[model samples]
Target: MKQVKINRLSDETSAQLQLLTIKDMMSLLCISRPKVYELMQNEGLPFMRMGRSLRFYAASVQRWLIEHEQVRG
Candidate 1:
C-alpha cells in the first residue's frame, strides 16, 4: 500500500499551551482513544490536567514518540 505522508501539524500551542484532549490525540496519532490514554498513563507524555480532565501537549507528543521510538528486530 502507498503511504500518504501528511505534514506534521505545527501550531503555536506552546504560547497558549493548547493541550490536546484524548480524542484529539487519537486523530493525530491515528490510534484508538484507549491506546492514547494507555500511553499517557505509561509515560509523562507532555500532559497537564484541567480540574479533572487530561490534556496533552501536541509538540511534546511528537517529541516523545521520536525520542522513545524503538527499532524492530
Candidate 2:
C-alpha cells in the first residue's frame, strides 16, 4: 500500500501536502507513462522539479480535478 502525508492548518488554507511517485500517478490517474508526460507538456498541470525529479502538488491536482468534473458535468 502507498502512503500520503496529512497536514493540518487553518480553515482558510487547510490543504494536505502529498508527494506522489511516477508509479503512484500511473495508478491514481490510470494513465500510461506517455500520457502523463503529454499532459505535463500540453496541459498546465502544476508540478515542481526537485533536483532531477518532478513532483506534483496534491492541492493543485485536487483543484484540477474539481475543475475537470465541473467541465465534464
Candidate 3:
C-alpha cells in the first residue's frame, strides 16, 4: 500500500483521519456512485458501518486501490 499524505488539510483532520464517506470515496477514485457500490460488493473493499452510512479508511482504500490495479494487470 502506498502512503497517502493529505497535505492539503493543515487542521487536525490531516492526522488519524481514516473514515471516508461514500461521496468522498467517489471523488477520490473518480468514479460514479453505482460503480463504487459495485466494487464494494464484488471486490473486497474494506469498509465500516457508521449507523446507516458506509465508511472507508484512507489507508485501506489506498491499499485496496493498489491491489485492484495489480489484479487488473
In order, the Cα lDDT scores of the candidates are 0.78, 0.74, 0.84
Could you tell which candidate, 2 or 3, scores higher by TM-score?
Answer: 3
Name the lDDT of candidate 3: 0.84
Which stretches of candidate 1 lie above 4 Å from their native place? Answer: 1-16
In terms of TM-score, how similar is model 3 to the real structure? 0.70
lDDT of 1: 0.78
Q: How far is each candidate from the true structure, as Cα RMSD in Å?
A: 11.9, 8.7, 10.1
Residue 37 displacement in candidate 2 (angstroms): 0.8
Per-model TM-score on C-alpha atoms: 0.64, 0.68, 0.70
Query: What tens-digit string does per-residue lDDT give for candidate 2 at 1-73?
Result: 9998887577545445676766667788999988878777887666778999988867777787676664434
**Which tens-of-lDDT digit does each residue in 1-73 have in candidate 1?**
9999987545564434557888888888899988877787786567888899988766677789899899999
Give me the displacement of residue 34 in model 1, in angstroms.
Answer: 1.3
Best by TM-score: 3
What candidate 2 gets wrong by more than 4 Å, as runs, is: 1-15, 70-73
Sequence-dependent TM-score of model 2: 0.68
Residue-level lDDT tens digits of model 3 in 1-73:
9998765875556544668999998899899999889899999888889899999978788878887785434
Please give the range of 10 consecutive residues that has the lowest summed lDDT in model 1. 8-17
Looking at model 2, the pairs that clash are none
